[model samples]
Target: MFAMLVDFASPVSLDWLTLSVIPILFYYFVYTIYSLYFSPLANYPGPFFAKISSWPNFYHSTTGYRHIWIWQCHQKYGDAFRFKPDGVLFNSPSAYRTIYNSRANVKKGKFYEIWPRNTQNINTLTTIDKSAHGRKRRVLNSAFSEKAIRSAAGFVSEHVDRWNEVFLADNDGKEWTSPKNMSKMADYLVFDIMGDLCFGKSFELKEPGENEFRHMPHTIAEYMQFMYPASMITQSPMMKFWVWLKPRGLDSLFESMLPKNIRSYYEFVEANVARRQKEEEVLKRSDAEEGRGRNDLFHYLFNATDELGNPGYNTDELYAEANLLIIAGSDTTATTLVGFWFYITRNLRVYEKLVKEIRTAFDRAEDIQVGTTLSSCNYLQACIDEVLRAAPAGVADLVREVLPGGLEIEGGRLPEGTQLGVAQWSIMHHEESFGDPWTFRPERWIADSSTGVTPEDVARARSAFNPFTIGAGNCVGQKFAMEELLITVARTLWRMDARLVPGDNLGAGSSKLGWGSRDKNHIVLRDAWISIKDGPMVQFRKRVD
Candidate 1:
């Protein structure tokens, strides 16, 4: 029987290689034609290659230009465009609401699942089920309550005060300190703050002395770079195979593939969580009052209760959420601070105005805490708003999958099973929203008739501005984030005078960075869900009376 089968194939000289290649090539050709002219999304405009495959999205992600690529497409294609064969991206405020609002007929895109280590590791951010997300969010909300925020403010102040002193090192009050990379400084400060709050012990990345965890921030960035594009590949033609493989052995494969730095980050989070849990157990056993009085974020989460009054999270769940808090709490704040320094240092006029407002708002640096007095500083808030608008930390879309019955957006209806979102970078920089979108003008946020920024102008801009995004999936800790920003900027400016190192522009965009990101004044960011950025090298001097 084997000899007869071999003799039959030898007649035409047909080989396994030719037979396998023919079907794949033929299938791709037919699929491309259908995707370009026959699919529900055929009418959407975008790059030709993007209309047929997910490679464009994957390639741009690898280059750290995925956000820019989306913006460039929107510039050519108008408010809506196809980013992947099955994905559509929008560049309007209404579209954003339609996709992400609480009542929107959509859930998180499937690509979100690629980030979790396994089913047990899925946290609030990666959960695709709407009901599961809601349950998780409710329990997590306890950690960011009004009372928790008031307590968190104390931690913020402690870290910010120490951070400021570090800037003045190696300098006398009479002269400016050497040029410091504000990006790296911001990372250390925010990372330490997050470590202290979430783990009950500061990583102390900001201190002058050596520390083992000093490279953790860079490790986190490296891990994001690997995961972001890998997630995008889940939408490619290999989606089915990838999805099937994940539960079988891909989890172990990914663990093996991670670089040493990335592995170290995982080990660090695991160690910290284990140590904190043991400490909590001791406190609960010996001194319940001490455990109840502990005000770190982990305390709230550790003590959180479900509707039935059971513990909200188990050990595995706690370990998973620890990663979430570190990235969400630290990276978002640090990215904003980096962008703020880039703009404020270059624009001296704006810097002087902000300095006057901050100094006048508080009598001493210690007075700049989270309160009514701090909240009243309009310029400081405007500055922060402008930073978010121009250089948002999460520049890419928070993608979602259309549910059954589809969604109506921007004067058209999308079919069910469509993956879509608003490109945050494109929408925030769109001309329809901000007349001078490329300019860094905090005054755009302040409603002043004399400056020609009328209430209507500010309202229109506010409608389009969603740095923390909106609706159910919005940043759960937005108020806490704002409190940190306000305190960091206000206190720093109150104690020190900052200026750009002469002719240094490490983070600013240039012509070489390609279209939609060429303005020299605009700060450039590499999107990795959260942003990765560099410097606006700056020098600071103590404010003389």
Candidate 2:
């Protein structure tokens, strides 16, 4: 009986356990072998798998510097290099054109998936569906048109006036350094404008330091950094769950999000939506008053119509889309202006030329209005462009998934679904693409054949200088952002005499975070000491006669 029992079941069951584990081990082993030596990426060079994976990004990108890795990759492997097994970093001007201006066949990749407000609301600004995105864009497109922007100039002017009164009034009539508060100042002004124009209410962030709205920028900065790691995971649909599973990156970012503060900003957006809706109701009653008094982007956008041939977005959709404006329009303007300040301060000669231009153009600081600054200040605009080239949100390297048909990048055929983009840093710094790529020469942008850059060169460089991106997925707020940057930077120059407060520079003090989709450096504040968060502190003696 015992022998029968053993032969029938017992020994066989033991073998089954071994059999089960055997396949699992074998599968893993094969996976390792494929990843190491035989996968599609095996030929492309990069740091070892462990370095390329999420761990280094999670650790280095968060606590200290993530940009260093990108710089290292380009240095080690030349322009076209592998960052991860699936992701390729194309660090050339040509590659940038290929990735950004891909044929209509290739749409925006899954990387932008997290840009939507939430699960329920996917608006035009964030949705990847081309037709849907196009439809949404059509309705909203009118407001951002050049004429519309000219009309909205006063809106920015009003905010700058409010900011000047709040900050400059505290100077006690002496050329003193009061905590180089440009970063915070820039934040308040940008957020306030974003709030009022989009939501129809000003947070008034530029007041005496204690304003609750002042912290909105910091809160945003925190949220932006916190989201990317989770955001990176979001692009990987299958790995989405990993973000919430106490991954170190997720944990840090989640902790940083600080619901109380983020909700304040969220509440502001929600409130702005409500206010905008009420205004739209009034607008319908009197779209007749037209350009008389009520001139905000809200009126135009809310009253817009979609391709489905109906009044565009509903209440919630309006709210979400407006917030996209907030996210896209606000900090970008502030950051660009802030970065512009950094660049100008470093190059005192550029600073003098810009200031001379602004001061010569407008006698008073407040007199330097948006439309006027935008129209005549070619040098100012060029300076702004150079800054964008030097420090773009899409600067590090943008990624695009090659569609099913594959891509011909720089004469090489990349397989479909292969992620690629031009390295903004590389392209902007390319000797061939930019002439003297490192030199901060604004005259290069002036329409002149004498400088060796013809209108064709200008067009080529302009195409290459896509700080706001290009083609379908380009930043819809580019015009608005440009207006803001030019206005704000011009005013700051006109009002103050700025310089690098002695030994310090404009780079980030701790780590440059919150550049949404770029690898930025030295972007912190530096007024008194060389710290990044403190911002530039110039001796503004109020440019008296």
TM-scores for every predicted model: 0.95, 0.83
lDDT string for model 1 (438-507, tens) is 8989999988888989999998998899988888899998999999999999999999999899989798
What is the clash count for each candidate, in the order shown? 0, 8
How many angstroms is residue 498 displaced in model 1 relative to the true structure, after the best TM-score fit?
A: 0.5
Q: Which model scores highest in lDDT?
A: 1
Per-residue lDDT, model 2, residue 443, is 71
When summed lDDT is taken over every stretch of 10 residues in candidate 2, the lowest stretch is 524-533
How high a TM-score does candidate 2 get? Answer: 0.83
Best by TM-score: 1
lDDT of each model, Cα atoms only?
A: 0.88, 0.65
TM-score of model 1 (CA atoms): 0.95
